[model samples]
Structure formats: C-alpha cells, structure tokens
Target: MIREGVMNQAQKLLAGLKIPALQAPMFLISGPEMVINACKSGIVGSFPTPNARTPEILDQWMAEITEQLSSAQNPAPWAVNLIVHPSYPRLEADLQVILKYKPPIVITALGSPKNVVEAIHSYGGVVLADVVNTTYAKKAASAGVDGLVLISAGAGGHTGYLSPFVFVNEVRQWWDGAIVLGGGISTGKNVFAARAMGADAAYLGTRFIPTKEALCVDEYKQMIVEASSDDIVTSDAITGVKANWLRQSLLNAGLDPDNMTAKGKIDFASNGADNKRWKDIWAAGQGVSASESVSDVSSIVNLLAREYVSAASELTQTLKPGNRE
Candidate 1:
C-alpha cells in the first residue's frame, strides 16, 4: 500500500495526467513560456530561480504565469526551482520571493537546507530535491523533502554518472516517497522503463530543448535535432561540475573532446555567470540523438503519450496466458 503522504503528493502531481512525467528544470533553457506550455500539455513545468535576473523580475514572471493560468479553466499546476548552494548568494532572497508566490511545487537542486525545506513546507508547498546518487537521496529524504529527483547518468547540466537501474533501485529500497528518475529519459518508452525500475516519475530535460517554447538559441536547437548519442560529451571543464554536453559545441569552441580536463575547482556561481565560459558550451544528454525534429510542446507531449499507451498495450498483450502459445 502507498504511504498516505506519498499517495497524497502523487495524486497532486498526477492530477491532470494519467502518467507521471515532469519537464525537468533546465538551467538556461526552461522559461515561462516553456513552463506554461508544459502545464497546458498536462505535465508539471518548472523554471530555475537564477533564470530570472533579479528578484523583481522573478516576481513578475511568477505573477504573469499565475494570472494567465488562473484565468484558464482547469489550469495545470506549476513549479519553480531553487538553487540551494551556498555559492548562490541570493538563495535566501529568492526563497522569500518563492514564499510570496507559493507555487504548488518547489524543486531544490545542488544542496538542501533544513530551513529552506521548512519554509516551503510552511506554505503548504511540496519540495522536490534533485540528487545524483543514493547518498544525496538519503540526505534529502532525511531533510523531510516531499520527493526526490534521481539525476542518473547522461543527464544535462550538473548531472550524475550512475545508471538508472542501479540508482533508482537503491533509492527505492529505503525511501517510499515520490521518486523521479532523471537522465536519458527522452521518449515515452523510457518513461515506462523508469516506472518499471520503481520510479514514481521520469524527469525529462534535453528532449524539451528542441521544443518551440524553450529559450534555447536556434543553432542550439538545430544541433540537438541533428546530433546523436555519440555526439554527447561528459566533462567538468565548463562548470567545474560533471555534466553532459554536446561534443559539437566543444569542437566549435576550439576544444578537443578527447583532451578535455576538469577545471579542478567547484564553481557554483552559475555555469557562465561571470565571463560566459559555458555560453558556447552546449549541454545535452545522450538522448538527443533520438530527437529527429523540432516540434511544439503539445506535439511532443501528444506523441509521447501515444507512444507510452502503445508500448503499454503491447506489453499487456504479451503477458496474457494464451499469447504464450
């Protein structure tokens, strides 16, 4: 039986949808338009705090989204991402803004603080912390987070390097809360696979970069459409944190993919906050190779939903007793 808290949170998350798929909050790619589109498509949409240049701007964005959605009948719920890292400097201030808006969900990344979780909880907001491994997952769970996003291998921007199979299974063994499996989950079949591996939802990022609502540059979106899994490179040279990136972007920036080295220091001050080192260094997961076209968010969602249903039906048919004959 599902725990009461987990069941309540899951019901809230999956209220307008049949399956669990969240549009992962991409560092620079996710924006108000993208979030709005995702929510309209019956999925949870999110944007990181840093995506807003200032606290006032953040408030404006939130107000606009809230007003627009409220006017629409049966509007889907939305989320905002908070970078809990100490280096962020403005985390406290951003948290205040989040409290004012009180989004239905708040996704915490990089680190988790007891006070932050408490503040969000005080407002009846659910906290979903992103973790790259079992250790972080346990730590986040211990902090009383409502859910955990498992950032497994091949994920874009500050990613983890473990397979979903190993990562999700280990977390499920101890925690019964809402768990979202991240990484190379671009297609609907991948979403089914995540559920099969005991994940409550699939966190998708790279695939949405090609969507029309995303804030990615035209060139970047085209690159994702043209590239394949083999074109992705994982390294810490750009952000001082291990993340998957497009190899073509590296080559275009005059760097050799095979000779890339770690920056040797952890700079949590945003990917290219200072001098724009990561501006040209495009981040992408191994799943980009599967994205063959640029489509609107609705089209992408519809196609994935159809694919998911078809795959599930095929699996059920195969499981029937007479099918074996």
Candidate 2:
C-alpha cells in the first residue's frame, strides 16, 4: 500500500501546475533565481544540493526559495535534488539542511532513497527517486518513494539508455504512483505527449539550461541555442557515467567527441576535482534544438503553455468522429 503522507504530498506538488512538468534540478545551472522564477511561472522548480557548494549556502537558498514562494501569488511547489549515494561526502551535511528547510519535494539520485525517506516524510515532504531503468524503479518503489523520474535516452547530463516509451510502460505495470518522464522533452507538445503516454509529468533539464536565470555562462547558453539533435554526443568520459554532451563544447575543452576514451570515476563530493572540468564541457540533450533563443523562465513557460494548449486542441480535433481518418 502507498504511504498516505507520500501520496498526499505527491498530489499536492502536482496540484499547482500550469503544466504537468518540472524544471529539472540541473547541477550547476539551477539556483535560487531559477527555482523562484520557475515556481512563480507555474511549474515545479528544483536544484541539486551540490549546486550550493556548501550546506550553509543550501540553507540560505532554501530560505530564500521558501520566503519568495510564500509571498508569490499561487506559486507552484519547489523541489530539492539530493545525491543519496553514500560516497557523496556531503550527503549528511546536505540532508541536515534539507530537514531544516523542508522543501515540498525531494528528488534522490545516484543512490538509494531509503536513507533519507523517513526523515523527509516526517515533515510531510515527498520523495521521488530518479531511476534510469525498471530495475532501479522497482528498487526505489520498494524503498517507499512517492514517485519515479524515468531518466530515459536522449536526456542531458547523466542519462538513461531506455526509451521513455519502453521505460514508462514497463514501470506502470507494477507501480501506480507518480511517473515523471525525462529525456529530450523540451517543448509543450513533448510534455503533452508524455501525459498521453501515461506519465504523470514531464521532466525537463536541457530546455531550461539556456534560460536567463541559469547559472551557466553566455557561451554555454549560446551553444544550446545553436545546437541540434545531432550536436549531442553521449559519453561517460566526463562524469564516469553515460551522459549527453554538446559536441562543440567537447571540442572547446580539447576532447574529441568521437574519440573520448577516458571513463572518469564517479564522485559526488562537493569538492571533487571534476567540478572544473564540467564547467568547461557543457551538457545538453537532443532537445537542444528547441531552444532557439536565450529567454527568461517566465517567457519560456508562457510559450510552453501556449504550445501545450494548441497541441491539446489539435489532439481533440484529431480524435473527433469525422476527423479520425
């Protein structure tokens, strides 16, 4: 049976959405400004704990997010992503900050959520596990998470290999809780398609990387604007896990996209050596083509809302008796 508190918190997170989507927790790209703007624009905003660089900074970020969202008009809920892997040196320190602030939703990645679920649930907060495949999905479900973020193929950063179609359908067979489909989803029509495929919400990361509020540099944003699906190359060289990267950024960093052979070790420590490397080698998914310009979070959301409505209307027409040819 689904835990009542977990289920309720999940529903509460979804209740305020203008669109069934989440501004995915990007590593260095997301911050207080992005989260605040995204919440104000009517979708869940989130950032990884590692983005703060320290627990004190995380405390300040959560405080600012809560203070701002509380004053905003009908702001959607905000989420915090945590690297629950034991090897992450700051996991305990980060979790303490999380407990003190109590973000409405906590997304756990890189490890089991079991270590932090009870503490988060104690404050009526919900936990969503980021799983790349059905095996991880089932394990997370058994760990008592409120939802699963299926990081399928074509996603940015550390991505999954399974197609969303295959992943979502396979997971739905056993789990009835929330399912947030991620991977190459950068448009409202993509969001609508996710819902049509039985996902409760769409998870978007690369789409938001070029926004004004993103912490990334101007050149990074510019690359995302100029990029297409073919520009994204997947390799485990940068982060020791399979993730998509912009081809040009790899070249700029002096690494050949086609010939990268270094399988870097995975380390989530706040002070890890790879931090500087990530800054130079940018990550983006196949959906980078959708970002035609550098815009504000509000404008992006507004455009997405319009596209979502149009897509829904078109679908309605297509399903009408005379139009179904």
Q: What lDDT tens digits, residue by residue, belong to model 1 across residues 26-130?
A: 877888888888888877889998788788999998998888778765656789999887788779888989999899999998886556988988889889999
lDDT tens digits, residue span 44-81, model 2: 99999988988898899999999999999999889999
User: Which candidate has the top score in lDDT?
Assistant: 2
Clashes of 1: 1
Quote the RMSD, in angstroms, for model 1: 2.4
Candidate 2, residue 153: lDDT: 98
> Which parts of model 2 have CA positions greater than 4 angstroms off?
1-8, 322-325
Residue 134 lDDT in model 1?
85
| TM-score to native of every candidate shown | 0.94, 0.96
The runs of at least 3 residues in candidate 1 whose Cα sits more than 4 Å from the true structure, single-residue gaps closed, are 1-11, 15-18, 270-275, 322-325
> Which residue pairs clash in candidate 1?
228-289
Local distance difference test, each candidate = 0.83, 0.90
Report the lDDT of model 2 for residue 231: 96
Among all windows of 10 consecutive residues in model 2, the one with the lowest summed lDDT is 1-10
